[model samples]
Target: MTEAFIPIFYFSGTGNTWWVGNQIAEELQERGCQAQPISIEQVTDDEAHELIEKAAMVGIGYPIYGSDAPLIMQAFIENLPAVTGQKPMFIYVTQAAWSGDGAYFMRKLIEAKGYQIRWAVHFNMPNNINADLGWIITMILKLFQAKLPHAAERAAKLAQHIVDNQPWIMGKSSFLSFGWTQRFFFRKGFDSSHKNIWSVDAEKCTSCGRCVRLCPVDNITLVDGLPQFGDQCNICLRCYNYCPELAILAYKRPYNPQMFGTQPYQGPVSEFKPEMLIEKK
Candidate 1:
């Protein structure tokens, strides 16, 4: 008999969603199912279509941006080829503070493509955006670190349920799901225009081309040994977090101040690998 294969498609900026997708993949494997975690940005449309076609189930994951789905994820969802019958699907969204309607929006997208949504889960992780909170940053890191065990366990259990074809539900918070008005406003106002907010410091940049390589959208180019931003950035902050020189700036006031540099999530998920998860008997 052919074994069931599950594919998890993730859009990660600073590796948060990648980590979550890996965790779920790990659990699915432990249950004797074949699962693979693939980064959406790393695959071409044809490759993505191939992955989806081979899978018996699908998993979609991403980090919430501007209280909604990141632009890249939206584009990926739109590009997916429709299925003949409904494919069982699950959604997982990670956010620093609030996911708003991010998971809801993604659920709708998946269902629109003839996928049956088995469940949608929201995870609150450390914010990747380097806010100038000083001492609060320490507190935030500590809190996220403390939540790792619970989050991993939740991910594993959810994946197990999917593997067993069992039903599970998460009573997500209502307050976190922002209204349509807010979603429309933020999606149009912030996410659509975020690419313009990034800037490169000519004095600080070493022309190492880290930002250029890290850009998921190919929205960066090197001109005269300095990185220049384009109009397609998804605000994933990969360049900001991965920059060794802290030269890339978001130019959004307190949200991206120069004083605070390279504030990426250093939580257990970021620090640990998926193989570290133990399959509970």
Candidate 2:
């Protein structure tokens, strides 16, 4: 047999994880491995289990949310197939900060599934669109400068880690993902309870439909010249994040206050389109 290899996968929301997923998949192909990209966004538990049942080598890619895994990716890992034997699994993470404990969290989740994790790495991308002024300004720039060189460099470096089969930090990630900081993310400030859910001023909306078009999840509907949000928000924070009128949030984006003074990841602005992960077809 050439190699019974496949990367049964993930990566959702802002496409940071998905970008890492694509870069890894491309590298695996270049090494002559048959790799596939699986999206966890619209997938069901049964579908996830079915894919795992057929694969020996697996890769689970995701963006860290609140220092833990994204709610959706964690749920998928929780429902992953109960492994019959030890399997080699690879993990990839995409994040705005240098702090995501990707492999440590992956090892915990996969041990529950009865698999042995082989290696993993963190791939830094520009911060995802957030309800921050800098993010909005940077996003508009990305529309014109999609192929930023730094993003490609980060993606390539992460891809090299996978093909070279090197250990990526072992378990240092546990200190952060399962650490005290995870508790702080839920502590009042970053949580939804503290979120400034968008409000329409009614004086300047202009029924423009820009927010609706910009929303990744279609979470908003303009009702009589104002946007309405009913509970279904990915909280990628994009609707409010990229709003042009400065009408998106009365305050600043809730998560990061120091963003104005620092570059979160080691990169420049780059656009990530969600639909590029159709490697299955």
TM-score of 2: 0.69
Off by over 4 Å in 1: 131-146, 169-181, 191-195, 252-281
Alpha-carbon deviation at 237 in model 1, angstroms: 0.3
lDDT by residue (36-86, candidate 2, tens digit) is 777865566787677777785778887655555655566677777878688
How do the residues 1-281 of candidate 1 rate in per-residue lDDT, one tens digit apiece?
02578878888877678777888888888878788888876678898899888888888888876557778888998898899689888888887665456666556667788998877777776556664445676456445422556668878888777867776544334665544556778767775567668787788889998678767778999999999888888877777766777677666333343444444443334464222221111
Segments of candidate 2 deviating more than 4 angstroms: 133-166, 170-179, 186-188, 192-195, 200-226, 241-247, 250-272, 275-281
lDDT at position 64, candidate 1: 75
TM-score of each: 0.82, 0.69
Pairs clashing in candidate 2? none
Maximum-TM-score candidate: 1
